[model samples]
Target: MRVRAESPGPSWADVGLAEPGHGWSGAVLAALLRRRGAAVLSHDTAAHLHGMPTPHAAAPSSLVHVTLPPGQRLRREGVAPHRRDLPAHHVGAVHGLRATTPERTWADLCTRGAPWTPEDLIAAGDHLLARPWSRRGRREPASTPEGLAAVVAALGGVPGIDAARRALAQVRVGSDSPLETRVRLDLIAAGLGEPILQFRLDAADPQCPEVDLYYADGAVALEYDGAHHLAREQQARDARRDRWLLARGVAPLRVTAEDHREACRRLVEVILGRRAAGHRIDPRPESTSQSGHDAPPAES
Candidate 1:
């Protein structure tokens, strides 16, 4: 049934969770849930919003029980809104406004139990990884204001990213990172489309390059050109591969540490588009290699 916020006030429905930075949306929703009789758990009320579904709970619906303030009788719905101090970790923001950040939510999700399978967690990470940086205007990080918002935005979420981020921190990649995850949150906030990750090309071998990050159907392949590729033998092999693919019309975009951060979206677009529009660069096509009947080309 549709809940409303009314009565001496509007029906609880009118007080649903609001968009980030909405007008008293957070406060209103908080009150409405309390009215619903959702005995709010003291340690975590953002439970629903921050944590995962409690499949094992007897009453998954009532799993959330809020403890409302003494005089704020919730006449709207049966759910109750708990008014207790949130632990340090549970506090953060999402989509700009102050709410629970994804990282914190992940940690909280883990702490709660195995409500979500290991695959679920991995999928969630994959789901959120490609995200870009934050676009919301500055929210003071504590003291500094100029460029401080970026810092605050980075630190705004859960600590899980610290591990994920650190784990893949050293690995040189063109698009995302080692776990085959998506881009970091900060990249998403900066206004970017999630680039295709780990896509397969129709090459004879069809073996995807280990370092490929952003790939288009037939467009460019953005390879994070790390220090490893600088070795003489590796460089020679890469040059051959580049020439071979160029002959087949697949332009390879070598993104460096600097370029990946600065020109991510544009670089991805140009490569993808170029390949689509018949870029001169060639890529080795799968299942179309020369037939065995054709002898190797005579020595030039």
Candidate 2:
């Protein structure tokens, strides 16, 4: 691909399509690497390459983020350059192009400053720690909670390390999606005590269903229903699970992307015994069951 005017020639060629598809980013990174061998794709670009969720607001699709050594700099039209000393362990390869490791990319994002909030950082951390399933079997997590903590600890003097540390403290291992992380954070912020993540009703039974967020004291189970719940088959399965939970005296509350906040508010009232007389807080009228499937991993 002929990426730059001043470059010697094409660094890579495509034998298939005239227009590059998903590999366009790789081609751009390759060309940039040709110009400066030390530069590596980092920040949002690395996050995307590592198959982690990249917040759209924090990473505009138009710009490719790159990191150079302490004194190195590259001013390119479509590239955003960051200067930092990346250790050997922090760098990795994605599709043959150099890029920061998933953990490093996440830490860099936390320290990137404004537009990257604590909630965003927490969500990213949850994603990194989540062990998603695949056709082959359960896949290993990108990083453990300890791995993220070590990264934060090593980044002592970095600009946003404090925010990263705070987010790290809140990151849990079982949240399946960013929405679940967000709802958990929101509920905690609202002064509701932290709910146990991926709570299983029967701890000894491997076949027992797990709730996304559960309050053992009140027997309240909060399940965040994402777009996948719209499927007819999933709906039927959810209905069965809800029936089973209700039969067991568990209050199975469901929250969709749209009504989560309201659900949380109603839950607080019910938990605190503040609901008005004759008022009742019910699960989302649709399906009130946990999603048995894990959140699909991001595309690599």
Candidate 3:
């Protein structure tokens, strides 16, 4: 029943009810498992199913990943099989296809041989815990920190367990993008202390802006301006936001892709300067707005 696929597209083979591709999707992987009826999707495959933040190195896989009960022999072609004991709760449906739970999938991704770095694993965890504005209009977190903690606690003597624990400690919910995660990590690595994620001033005031990274002690806020911040409309809006922050005596630092190399350095200077000046450095919005885009675009 091997044949080329057109709808889900090339590099795919149709094996009766299942269409497995080099980069087989979760639904396709689930279909393959349903045909086998004894295996559940796991590892990176399951991570994709759960919509976790994939690592930068991730590419389409040539084989579908599935886990079977211990002693179950699977001789299916195009399927990568592992013999493991999966709890019932850990096995569930994602996108109508049977796959490991988000927590289980995240844990598996942290294991040895999984193609993910510590940061990638942490970002995935953050994604799981984020309440993003999706098509569903404000989607709830797929998993919680407490749930992830329990999973890690219960899984003792597991392979890659140390890495999993390390990643868990770095995971923080409310990080809206990978850039935000990197900035947070970079600040800590640079001895700036941990910047709060999505920190807001005056919670009662809707006019008060929430920042990507907030240094409450120094009243300094840093924003990671990705591609979206480059638009003229967005630039104008950011200018207004900067003015608003300046009026409140908050030092707003906007980091664009260009500033990656010097961002931490510049940030340290600004924070120290503001601290030395005793937060009286600037109270006028007109004096603080930067020229050009919110964040300089990456070099061509």
Q: Pick the candidate with the highest lDDT.
A: 2
Model 2: per-residue lDDT, tens digit, 79-132? 789999999998988767799888889889999866677887888888888777
TM-score of 1: 0.32
TM-score of each: 0.32, 0.80, 0.79
Best by TM-score: 2
How close to the true structure is residue 236 of candidate 3, measured as C-alpha lDDT? 86
Better candidate by lDDT, 1 or 3: 3
Q: Give the TM-score of candidate 3.
A: 0.79
| Per-residue alpha-carbon lDDT of candidate 3 for residues 34-105, written as tens digits (9 for 90 to 100) | 677878888766765566666756654566678899999777777778788888888888666788899888
RMSD of 3: 8.8
Instruction: List the candidate 3 regions with Cα displacement exceeding 4 Å.
Output: 1-21, 25-27, 57-62, 75-78, 134-137, 231-233, 258-263, 280-300
Question: lDDT by residue for model 1 over 238-286, one digit each (tens)?
Answer: 7776765566556666666555356356665665466567654223444
Poorest lDDT segment (10 consecutive residues) of candidate 2? 291-300
- Compared with the true structure, the alpha-carbon lDDT of candidate 3 equals 0.69
Ranked candidates (lDDT, high to low): 2, 3, 1
Alpha carbon lDDT at 43, candidate 3: 79
Candidate 2: residue 103 lDDT (0-100): 84
